[model samples]
Target chain A: MAKAHVYITYKNGVLDPQGEAVKDALSSLGFQGVGDVRVGKYIEIEVEKSAPDEIRGEVEKMCQELLANPVIEDFRVEIPNGNNNPQPPKSEA
Target chain B: MAKAHVYITYKNGVLDPQGEAVKDALSSLGFQGVGDVRVGKYIEIEVEKSAPDEIRGEVEKMCQELLANPVIEDFRVEIPNGNNNPQPPKSEA
Candidate 1:
């Protein structure tokens, strides 16, 4: 199987209200010395096949068609190791 | 200089309403084959120093202070190369 890691973030020069809200909330909770908060989105998808070209097409389609709001958000997709077979690291637990 | 990358997502076993909303939005936009959609937050911070222990402490403080919602979101902090000098890959453009 192949995995696609997608990151969606607000375009540069745009103000992020959600990030500001979170920052305010944090300050109220007594966390000081923190500044400049920016928030973005991350998604991971697993596909049954491992072809880079095909996966790239699918991921681009996915991002354009549904994953991102192209108007305000820019997205980046990563395919680890050229193989499309990416897995989350195992935990010792 | 040092950098901190923080990722925040809904806690396991929690329902991700935003993901569901996005999935529905995608379907309405005519995208098929996307079965699941989960949304999370990603943040990168640039700090003035590169000391590992001090940077770790600062990052934890930042996450606990304003970057994530401890009530509903779980977070992970990554210190790239143990030096806090992580940078985005350069683009050929």
Candidate 2:
């Protein structure tokens, strides 16, 4: 098993209404330090018997083909520990 | 400046409509291996000057206050390098 973490965000110059709304709400809630809030998507996948690189490649294809609108969104992928184990300790040490 | 990465996903037991849509789309795109898809939110914040722990605390408060609906969403925060720098190399080496 392998774990893939994916992030999808609006392309540069695109207006994110959901982010704006969250920013407004934050300000109202006394989080005065927050300036701009951009909201996107995060997805975690558990794949069976795939290498990290192969899983990442497949996930990128997934993002481009269906998960995100490549025309208006940018996406990123992270494979924790360079392996399929997702239950590893959070600390490197 | 410090960078903050926040991820918000639907709480356990909550139905994710967007996730369902993405799953359907992926199946149509020939990604037949994907079983279930759960879509959530990813937020990146650039703060002026704040310690990692302090920034994480603020971000948690922000998540609880407005960024995520605690009633239906759960969140996680990642501080890339335990510091404010986000331009570090991808590999620790």
Candidate number with greatest TM-score: 2
Best by DockQ: 2
Off by over 4 Å in 2: A83-93, B83-93
The CA lDDT at A4 in model 1 is 69
Instruction: Please provide TM-scores computed only on chain A for all of the candidate models, following their numbering.
Output: 0.77, 0.82
lDDT string, candidate 2, B1-93, tens digits: 677888777776889888787777777877757766678778987655468888877887777766677777777777878854434212111
Q: Is the docking of candidate 1 incorrect, acceptable, medium or high quality?
A: acceptable
Question: What would the TM-scores of all predictions be?
Answer: 0.69, 0.78
The RMSD (Cα, Å) of candidate 1 is 9.6
State the fnat of model 1: 0.36
How large is the interface RMSD of each prediction?
3.0, 2.0
lDDT of 1 by residue, B1-93 (tens): 566667777776779988788767767876556566678878766555567777777777766655667777777777777854544322111
